[model samples]
Target chain A: MGKNIFRSLLLGLVMVLAIQLVALAADNQFSGVQITVQMQDHSATRAIQKLLPDFEKMTGMKVNLVILPFSAMKEKQLIELASRNATYDVIMLDYRDVAGYGEARWMIDLGQYIKGPLADPNLKLDDFLPTGVQSLTWKNKLYGFPFYIESTMLMYRKDLYDANALKVPENWDELYANALKLNLDTNKDGQVDFYGCTLRGLRAVGYNDYIYNGFLKSFGGSYFDDKWKPIFNNENGMKALETYIKILKDCGPPSVATFGYEEVMQEMMQNKTAQVIDATMLGTWLEDPEKSQVAGKNGYAMVPKGTVQRGNSFFGMGLGIPVFSKNPDAAYKFIEWATSEQVEKSFINEGAFMTRSSVLNTKEFKERWPLFANLIIDSLADANITYTPILPEWREVADFVSIAVSTALIGEKTPKEALDNAAAEVEKVMKKAGYY
Target chain B: MTKTRRDNTPQWILIPTITFILLLTTFPMAYSLYNSVMDTNLLKPYLGSTFIGLGNYFSLLQDGRFWGSVWHTVYITVSTVVIEFLLGLGLALLLNREMAGNRITRTLILIPFMTTPVVIGLIWRFLFNYDLGIINYVFRIFHLPQVLWLSNQSVALKSVVLVDVWQWTPLVALILLAGLQSLPIEPYEASLVDGCTPWQQFRRITLPLLSPSILMVLLIRTMDAIKMYDLIYVLTEGGPGTVTETISYYLYVIGFKLFYTGRAAAGSYILLIIITLISMLFIKLLRGQYQEQP
Candidate 1:
């Protein structure tokens, strides 16, 4: 009886081993395949890199990661796509670039892949943040998988506000009033030691517009009408420009006009500024004890309401397979794995923002970044990409607007004159692009 | 027969180098020239490359930003070159004398020149930062009001020039020092025997002899300054209302950011023409100076 029982146990172990081999074979079907991924140098990409070895081991596929800074990455991707180089199988694409890439047919539509063999019941597209998914979709065709979403929000020093008995700003007027009130010289050195607020003021094309467009949109200003006519020189547009310039000039740092995202975040993190209306990404950096002095002393809010609208700006960084990719199948496999719910949760734990609603709603995430998770959800409702037009000429138009806004900031031109000049230039650009 | 073969061998060796150079430079240049006259909008390629003769040039001529950028380029080039030359000449003269740690000082001066331009730009950007910069900190120590080095439109261009001067002045000094070391001691001795004062000797003997090196340095630096991108790109990015938007930076915006290939090519050709003209004028002046020399 004992010999018969031992023989039965050995047979059971062999059957289990055979089933595991078959499962491994199915998962590693594309073993030995190599795909190159091009991405921007960011914390999210770094997290993906850390997970790549596990992916390689599981799928038996090799991933060659090429990470570059944001601007250089875009330029490289553009050059590669234009040249039809099959150098990169996967690329990190900005949602703002969807229109240009989609219209150019440079990226493959992943809609079919979603419903086909790569589809997993657990990987639901509906689970992603609606704005993020919509941004990556052009003409009802999904061109990429949303990786992370970002929107503008108001971040202020909670300690400072409570100590001063100041209320969280609900509108532009209150924001400006609070900024002026908080612009204090804490050291009493006859100079303002701490600024009240900071925003992006760099004059590069599309840079300043990213932050200032919130003001423009909230003031009932639109970049262009349906006919592509320049409309930013209207009364509302001038008011928006004036308000943006006035606030920065009066309550912001003396060098506010030179501040970009990095500068503003640094200012706030170092506790030199009491408030900042900037990117959601700044919240994560500011909460880190390693980089920030006031890690837990911050309060998050949706961008203050403008006169006519909140005009919050929304953008997403996504992953897309280029049309020129040689290993599209393997590339899709990797993209799916990287954007999977499991990986997204891991990414969040590693301090990356997530685009999936499920991951964001998870008890674990809410407990980790309690302040930002709630603010992100609230801000997404009012966030609009109209501030950044989704067109090929959008970059050029944003540049013109940035120049105008910067000119107003530096007193080179009045808000009205600057907007008028920018409008004329934009019209010229549109005409040249055959937008008649 | 052997002499003829030897001569032919040199030609054969020269052919490969010439071919390589032409392939690298001439092809892109010709393509740019062709593209300048054609509607080659990468975004609107469906429109096809149409021959639009002088259309881009005419548009650029009417472009106020283009003209503004050209003016900025001229201002930056002239100011940087002038300041660098003066400062370099002064340092070169000082170093030319017998002094303690002269070799160490010369090597130290070359450090800025040795550093990458992009790195130099970043370092200077931090140093000139309005709030946290060491410059403003020093000003604060003296109880002086803070100056908006990069934020003020009037001061932004000057701040960029200061960075350029800091980086390239060492190069100019090195070049002028080499020239100073090569100068004949006999002329100085003769000038001293003639009871010439130090200032007089320098203004006459030193300045005349250093003119060739000065002109060479000016020529090289002018070309570089006109095409200055990395410094301005990293430092101010032609910010503070485009006060520092040099021609090259503007062309980069048109090409890469705007993706107006045809317009960018045309703008580049225009810049090329300006650079060629300026270089030719400098060459002519240099030739005249050479001819004036005994």
Candidate 2:
């Protein structure tokens, strides 16, 4: 009778413990709420999705994903998020858009969630690249988690460089010389199949802002002065632009001025160019043999020095939670988990770059892919993390400026004339919009 | 206009229909007009907007890009419709005759017409890519001047026109084919008996008979071509130095991309006026034919 009673009591205790554990897991798992994320295609989406099983196992939270093309995703997400439908629980945002979204109160102020010494003991804020962690903040308030932050650097074909007995260019003059040498008529057909270098000069938003802004910043020209005056037409800015345009003409593909991100990617993939200044995210595609012919034959280097600076590449996108989410607490929990070092390791295992400093410098990751790990970390660390000061007026300013540049490059207008015209139009936009 | 009084029909049906028209059409038109007078940027909705009255319209009048786009729209609309109408009429006549495999040919002709504009634009964009395009491939095959199809500002409009022709010419052919099918065979036989040549018969009798259908096709195509958006948006997005920027493209840039609601509204009102005038002119041209009908 004593043995039977003891056995029954022990069994009951075990069952009670099991039931409590299940209830605790259920509480963390989101109680079956479906959180949708509107994100762009980079290494991050696959990495995040890879963790879904584990997420469900640990928290019981189910994540629904809707990944869109980068351009389409931005337009659709902004329209939906701005209208306050909260259709997306999480969204991918660049530093430039953080201010706009934050000011509009579209994104949750994640300061409280990520504050007080990193919320969760497992997830440390200091583990992230300092700039990347800082980039997600607007008005000194955290609004996003740094997913896969990126900036541009010069990528060249190592095989091509060795075969031609050439060296990496350090400055504009050296770059021009290298470009001339690399612009070889390989088959002596008089038609240049392999161009020296290329950059996106297309009128797309990416080209207009990121690529052109890279050039503008490299020339030591800020969009606005301390008082927010348009400095795009300043002397250093104009000189930088002229040199950039000239170099593009001499070095780039025949129709590069019209090439967008996709076009530049094609040129690099086909090994038709000696070098290209593109986002480090391209390393993922370049390393994939199926995606690139020059896979494993590429070398990474810092972007060439311009007249005013060495390089002025900027960070791209990060994961953000919208403010109108019905389940902010659950969303915050998921974010903390996703941005954790464990998640970063998972991303590295799946061939994705993580913005976390802890994962980026790990001995294991460095051994797997030294150049990629270095390039991403270096760019994110050194990049100009300031959101474009003219972010609010960028949509209109970009179009007007691109038109001017296009005209000048095509020889329809002189650089002076083009810059003057563009400045006039931009000034009018600022005045009408109450910016100036 | 006479309002039809119904006896058996319910007034509620008209009520719903009228409400729908007001909601979908009239309300938007009124809203646009109101927005045109106010300097509202949808992207910055919190900013206190000021009423600018006719300032936006006045500014648009002086805007060079606006005028350039207007000219581009005219060029595209005129060139595409005229060429398509001619080609379409020829195809319609050819199909009207007893020929081998007419059913298959008709179905094949409808394929391009049935494709979504976005898909058509993407397909053509790939086909015309200067670097890795089939059109350039064919050019290499035939030893032709490998034209910079979308890159060269001077020729981008022509490239877009070519795509428009490829897709919409079939529409014209089908409509004209209907008109050709409905025509009496006796008139052609009588003309043949009178020693009239094929060209003469076509010019005198067939053309006169086809006038109503041709006018309808022209008017519809003119309006559509004027409002052209999807294919152009997908293909070039009014790129390569604004060479292919049409009125609709300008409006989209101003409204959606640039968030200049007032300017876009002003642009649409101008477009509305132009379309209305053209419609009136077409109606006047077709008045005599309709007057002699039932």
Candidate 3:
């Protein structure tokens, strides 16, 4: 009796295991092809839901999104690609990640694919705001395709400027002159409650990218020469740092050093600052009265030019394919569809910043988001890819550099001392990681 | 050697406990220790790992960042424990006495202690903001210098410590209060008849009786404080220039952020050793008090 019962139990267990395996197999579409994408969940989980159906319809392939926070997205992409696991077929590689992922043979060389069917006729790759295309390349190989790109522009209260009869400044001298005129302290208050401008100085990578990069670029400071050595503490760099400190201290609110992205956004929304600097992405929310306090009253213009470099900013996310991917053809087709004009139109309609020139010029899109449409194209025109440094170990080095910048801004260390110390530490880390 | 053998009591209890512990604890502990001695990257497999012996440990000893994190962890742990103990004891004494609505007050005290660490951190962060925060608004209205609570490196660590104390002090109070309520009445009566002052009676009779419970609370608090990561992480992110970076936070950034798996393992083992030593010392002290009690 015991032997008979044991045989029956074994048969039941085998049936259950077989059913589970079949369920798992059914969950996978595209049969043998798999792709992974690294994108930020910035607007909750539904950010990617609208585009998935179109991608599937066009290419008949399955995609798996390994969603990450904005803070960790770049670092996660580098680590995952370096392993050559083919863990992701489509990756959201920023300009900073292109150098490392390309050189390491982790990303499939997209030059061959781009010349073929992946290059959509309507979505001309050459027309991708020259600066955006330049950021997606390393040594003639276009490793990534432009997705959403941004350059910082001046966001100001048009009402405040009109009430005070101030023209928007196109240069630093004018900016300072106007800032002084706008520092208003109303109603017998001893303190200056309303400041002219507010910007990020916190110890985070966004602080360095948005605030310090503009200052350095405008001051004629280069991160490295062709030989790759630190040149950021030279005369030009010092002049830039000095100017930044002076402006922030003299015109900014008392707690500017601790202001991060959220704080600056809040301050601008509250109309506490006469002028603020931010990426073009904010234009969508800033123009909506339901979301913004200064909705129609906000003025958009190109970031003012400085001593040498023009008004400078950077590109955002780019798409790349893994070298180990089994179906590079299918993956490239999906990338083409994802960045095509139709998809770009849909995303823009949903309030996402897409980076195809033809899509940005569409009459309907222009009419609906005029403020974003006008300033977005102009800002990208003067964009300099050199301003945002691209190193193989950028994630590690960028953080240390951010800390140094924060210390300088907070008066914990002088600019020269901070940069020198930070550069030395970065060199050491690069050597240890075999980057040099 | 009796004809009727006793049920193997020790063996029955020993077998299940040993099996449970070996599966859950011993295996992971051994695996992590083994990984610490070797240099391996989880992402790469074709490029095989090397056995570095003690190379990772030696490098960590020379790393200034490691020592900085260790010092930060020690400072936070010591400060939190001392403050929590004193404040918790004071509340326990106050609650022990008769008061209006004492039961309601005790229930209210436990509410903060019952909430999760992440919730506590988020609430406190909202309170400490320079703008749109109630604390800052009150300070500004009073003409006081508004503290940049989460921004200034000098003040960020202290702010997190204060949040921790606020959440966990009630736990200590409840434990000490239970101990106070359980003390015998004869000692107090005897001390009063001996003409001892209130301070003397507290020192001579009440404290001696409460030593065991106090020692128990200290041990538990020290262990919990050494492992504090979530609260500090959510509060400041080891920042304002890594001023609040504790040992666990450093390990997390290296392991998960930088993908330095070998280095992170070594750092974690160092933390384990320090915590173990602390626990052992507290247990020894508690054992001494237990033996001294009657």
Candidate 4:
């Protein structure tokens, strides 16, 4: 009787081993495939690195991630993509670049895989934020999938506002008024001892133009018309630029002309400046006790509303398969795994940003980020994807506008004059590009 | 050896070297030359990047911003090279004497020169920062008015010059020191016997003998100053409304940032021409002075 019982136990063990082997075979279809992905260093990418071993194991494929600093990543990606043989199977793309890359035919269109036989049933593409999805779409075809997104918001010193009995600003006028009232000379020096605010005036597309575009859009002005003619010299655009210049020049730090994200964040955190109207991701850093001095003393609000609508400029990053990729199928599989619900949910504590609405709409997410959760969701809804022109010549156009903004702020030219000159130059660029 | 084999040996050996050099330098220069003449905008294929025959060059010539950058480049080059020369000469003369700790101090002064240009730029950028920088903090403590070293349009370029001088004057001084040491003791002995004063001796003998080294310094520094984009990138980024933008920085924006291939190529070729002309002019002037001096 004992010998018969031992035989039965051995038989049960064999049955379990066979069942697990069959499941592994079914799941690991691309057992020999390998793909490379080039990405920028971000919290999300860091989290993905931690979670990457699981992806490689589950898919039974080798994955190589090449992370680089942002500017280097952009330049290196272009160099690789522009070559006949792109080494990276997948690459990170800025939302503004989707149109350029699509037009160049450098990136493979992912719409077919999203809808075709390779499509994962559990992969809810519809769950991504519509703003992100819309930004990634070019000519009605999805060239990429959004990975991280940020929108413009207002961050301010709550303690300072309370001490001065100042209400939170709701619109451009109110923001300007608050800045003026908060502009203090505590030591009675002619120079402002305590600045009211700081705004980035660094002359670059990704620097000053990012902030200035919001004001222009909120005023119902635009860089170009439907026909691609320069329209930012209009009355609304001029007024927006003028107001932006006045606040920057009169109420900010003496070095306000040079302030980028780093300077602005430093000033706000060190309590040298009272407020900054900038990116949504900064809210996390502001509230972190270790990284910020004004941690508990900070307040969050939407970007100030303009006359027609509030200006919430959207910025997003996405991933795409290169056109020259040898392992397109494997590349697609990797990206799918990267953007899946499980991966996005892991970003909750791993990284602070997510592109999916499902991940962002959870009660847990709202509870975790009590300050920015609701504001981010609302701003994402209102975020203007085309706040600045999203064309291939966008860098050139944005540079012109940023320089104009700087000159106007420094009293070298009136806002109207600066905008007009920029408009003329932009017109020349458009005509040269055959946009006429 | 057979004439055929003998002739073929040198040609065969040089073929790879010649081809490599051509590929390294001439090919890109020629390619840029070709691109400069076409309407080669990669982004706008609709325009059909056909042969436009100097359209980019013409536009750049007429471009005010382009001219502004050219002027700024000249200004920065002159300012940096001159300041570096004066300071370097002073340092070199001082170090030429027999003194304690001369060797160690000489080695230590080279520390800045040994650093990578990008790292040097980043370091100076922090020091020159207006709000959080030690420079401003010190000024505050001493009751000195704080100066916006980099943010102010007028002072921005000067601050760039200051950093360049700080990092490079040591190199210039070292180069001149070598020239100083190599100088014959006869000229100083002769001048001493003639009862010539120190200033007169320096002017008549010391300077004329050091002309080669001085020429070397001017040439290297001018070329280097003309290519002064790295510091501007980290410090001012050609900011305060394009007041500090040099030709290299402007072309960088045009080429890498704007991606206007043909226009950027034209701008690059224009810069190459400017650099070559200035270098030629410098060599001619220095050599002329050297030959003409009694």
Candidate 5:
């Protein structure tokens, strides 16, 4: 009877202890805490949304993810930030906008959180591409964490080129020649059924200027001098305009002037356009058999060289916690988790291109996206961001440039006339901004 | 005291609605007016804003792009309103007559107006596409030369105007048809007894009586067309080198895209002044027409 009583008492004590431990572990760490994240509708964001349940479970915090179309997202974010609204705790920012956003102090200085105890050491900040990190830094202060880095490259139909015994174009001259030779009228309809190439010609600051700057930089033209004087009206600038118009008008599709990324991508994937010069992210889409008719027949190469140099435009999208966020620490945690190596690896497996070197160089990633891996590294080596000025007034200037280039493309004005007019407008904007 | 209390009841009932309108409309107007006189650029807040009275307005007058956008707006508004009025009036006249399928046709015509402007823009953009558009395919079948509807600068503005006409012409027609139905039959019977031709009856009686409806449709459509943004934004985005950049679209680019709040505010005020003047002119003409009739 004494032994039975002792055993029963010990078992009850052990059960009580076990129940107490379970209650402690299940306790809400961030109960009642909610953070809203504003991001563009992209594959990466979709992947992030899929993993957010895990985040909520771990921290006991709620997340409100607001995804919007690309253009609408930028406008909404700008409005929210400018209004000093704490509505969005986290925001997705294009690297090009960092200068403008950081200068306004709209985003929190993330250096502290990055170096503090909240940061995971495994993130290995140095593993991010230098260009991606550099673009997101303004005045030597990091404002955001890198999401994905992108550069422009040439995407072409390999079967068409190989069957025609054509070598990949090395320079503008060869590009023009190859384009003209490959512009075929398959049904002899007198109209070319296959366009030589399709490039972004939409007259928007982001759509047209992004691709045109690559040509501008490669042609040895600069947007502004060291003192911030507009110099794109110079000889080289005019030459770039002339060459761009000539090639696009002569060899491109009839409606190339209205084509943005979607139109260009669709045309190439449908086997309607023989080549395209666009963002590096397009390679993955082009290789997807479900969306592409020329999947295995596609070839990747560096952007064509110009008279003076060969260059690529570097850009990326990053995530930043807004200065108005009420839950800064929680927001930081989410950013850290979302951009971690393990999460980025999964993102890569789901076909999201990431900025981390480890993600791009991993054996599985390289094998799955070999073309993109090779092209991204090669293009990053020669990519330049100077073409699109990293100034607060850069967007205004780009608007004028987009109009000038588009007008010239449609044969409305001579290249010199259009560029000079745009230069004058840019000068006025700069003068008003006190850049004189 | 009781009579005064009863009078106050209406004011009390109206207070909430009046307050709502003032909050939604007057507050934003006042705020924009204040912002217009300040040098405010959201992206350059470090520079800070200063009361630069009339600075933004002065710069706008000197800005060529501002004037160019104004010209484009006026051009598009005039072309769309004029064409829509003519086609709408013609359709209204035809539909007013006794016809077998009038009911179905009336309902079918409302489809375009029922559709969203952005969706209409997208559908038209695909139809006007140069390479793979069904419109071009039809033209090829007929051996007619394909036109670059959205690419060529000369035709891009016209294409946008065409889209506006397609969507809003039905609304105008319906308004006019209601006006036509309400018109007395005595004048037409008298004209027929006097051996008057159909054209003479339409000009002398029908047109004079229909002037009020015509003016009403004109005022509504003109206002909407002048502030048009969505269709243009989705279709051409003021492309082919600002050939179609309307004033409202320019204001949007300045305010949202460039974050030049001060300049955009000034631009909006200028547009407001223009619209107000146009409305006053139309109302004065409408009042004169009413007085002249009775």
Candidate 6:
């Protein structure tokens, strides 16, 4: 697997290097074009914004930015897409949203633009992470290009692990054992000072349910069968949920069910938790010396597995041109420029979520982010996109499952009861959509 | 009579007003009603808006989650309104008294209702956080068990109700206080001259005179409470297994997230009817009280 990754890495480098020279000499054709782009107000997007002036200078095109929080951004995009608004030329593209947008034909098919003579060779498609590129493609046509990608990974306190003479867990059993041993009571207080584990239990598709997908895939449970029938209530799913509940109840914080990504990450920064298994993006916050109490004292590893051999999640966010855009060529130019490797490298200190393999291979990146750079690339190389299938109804399906998982967490329903109910509802949704 | 009034004076003034009103109000209702009878889901673009009369309603009636949300909405509305009425009346009566700092106290009472609902939800969410909230912190300090305010399903709806009550009781109290200030002093003076107790005067005169305002409060609060969405949307997000999902929240999920526009419109009409019936009940009661006295 490592050798294969290396070969692809070499091929991407050669392609990028060959194209870089050709792209730098290309003409700025659409100098007067003004394009507005909408994006989520996230750390990476803020970092990307800093390079907007340079792009403006290089392309001689005016760019407008409309940034909003995640949910609001999605809602706004939906409203605009549904109404066929020409207000935004370029929009932030979530990999999960690719199917919905593509099927709706609300996005311009970038496969046409990203390849052949129309393509900007410096756009460097091969340089983007494999899963990142694949997730943005729908029905064998490329719809967008990911500029940032992250996957689930284990983040733990190195001091605690070393003091206990523990090795990083490779599978579920070892993880559970370590959690048990690390549930510590310090300061001679009867109450536990440091929790052994914490995972989000907030009832939202993108919150707790995001992490839960890793567990589901690890246990050999798929959300659907070969024929698109809901089968997640099977024994494998129940086991996955049962084990999830066991970890949170036994070693997590008392308010684990109220935990979201922000809260779990907060617990780590406050030194109240020993470990968390969440998106690799969390490394940026947890390793920040100004914000974190445990900065530079953390260990990183791949997300532990279950009885099955597969598990970690890979997802991405990118940019795409709206179908109604007046300046499709200019919009594509902006996307290509924004995701280019040079722009990605310039904003590394702000914890830019790099998309290019060349950036990952940089010695500066490795030295600066020693905690997560290596582990992230390793996980990315083997990132399993099939763990969470790209369906047009993903938002709705994942939301239903999230509610069920939350129900089990709060002791309102058993894992079997909740998962079974959710499976039935999801099946109904599929039937209603004529997917049966 | 004044220049015979018919020469070139346009009769089209009412046209613009009528058109504006209909576009603002009637058009959406008509469009949604039309959608409710058809398969208008955006997700299934292939399945065009085919006329499936009563199909959406039939499915909604059979939908277990829809019914659960209806029950949840009723629980939140009834609990918050009832609790707010009782507490609000007590507050109105107290403020009606000639007590020290009464003016300042009255102003302070308005603070909760004056704050935006979203901000209230955010503040209360922090205050009710199970591990780190101020309420739980105080409970820990007092050696009392911490409550699962947002996490536990059985308690979540009640927590939402409590937040609603906290934010709205002041509005109810202020309305009742206005009614109290407007009450005639003659009956109470007459009762005092006749050696009647304060309770007797209040029970006989004050309550009867305040019935209209009380009914008004009931009408407004009930309609507002039934459409409760913002608070729970930010607080529990219909969590701990759909326990706190109100009818409006469920309708939102169907319309926006699921894109089952037909089902959502149908479900919305059902909620509209429920609100209409409850408002009519309050209005009828108010009419009867006025008829008896007038």
lDDT of candidate model 4 versus the reference: 0.85
Scoring each candidate complex against the real one, what DockQ results?
Answer: 0.56, 0.37, 0.24, 0.44, 0.70, 0.47
Sorting all predicted structures by DockQ, with the top scorer first, yields: 5, 1, 6, 4, 2, 3
* lDDT preference between candidates 1 and 3, better one: 1
User: Model 4, B256: alpha-carbon shift in Å?
Assistant: 1.1
Residue pairs that clash (backbone atoms under 3 angstroms), model 4: none
Residue A403's C-alpha lDDT in candidate 4? Answer: 93
Model 2 pairs whose backbones collide = A29-A59, A29-A60
Candidate 5 residue-wise lDDT, A1-436, digit = tens: 9999999999999998885565456575554579999998988889999999888777767899999999899999988888899999999988878988988889998999878988777878898888888888999889888887788899988899999999999998898899998899988978787889788888887787788888888888999988888999898898788888888888888888888899999999898889999888779899999999989998899999998777577778888999999998889888888888888888876673678888887887888787767777778767875557898777789889999989888888998999999999999889988887
lDDT of 5 by residue, B106-180 (tens): 999999999999999999989998878899989989999989999999999999999999999999999999999
Model 6 regions more than 4 Å off: A1-28, A116-118, B1-16
Angstrom error at residue B156, model 2: 1.3
Chain A of model 6 scored by TM-score: 0.91
Top-down lDDT ranking: 5, 1, 6, 4, 2, 3
* DockQ-superior candidate, 3 or 5: 5
Model 2: docking quality category: acceptable
Worst 10 residues of 6 chain B by lDDT: B1-10
Q: In terms of TM-score, how similar is model 4 to the real structure?
A: 0.92
Predicted chain B of candidate 5, TM-score versus the true chain B: 0.96
Weakest lDDT window of 10 consecutive positions for candidate 2 chain B = B40-49
Model 1 lDDT vs. the true structure? 0.87
Top candidate on DockQ is: 5
**Count of steric clashes across candidates, in order:** 0, 2, 1, 0, 0, 0
Over the stretch B71-150, how does candidate 2's per-residue lDDT look in tens digits? 99999999999999999999999999899999899999999989999999999989988878999989978878787787
- Model 4 lDDT tens row, A306-337: 88889778899988998899999999988888
**Which scores better on DockQ, 2 or 5?**
5
Worst 10-residue lDDT window, candidate 6 chain A:
A19-28
Off by over 4 Å in 1: A1-27, B1-7
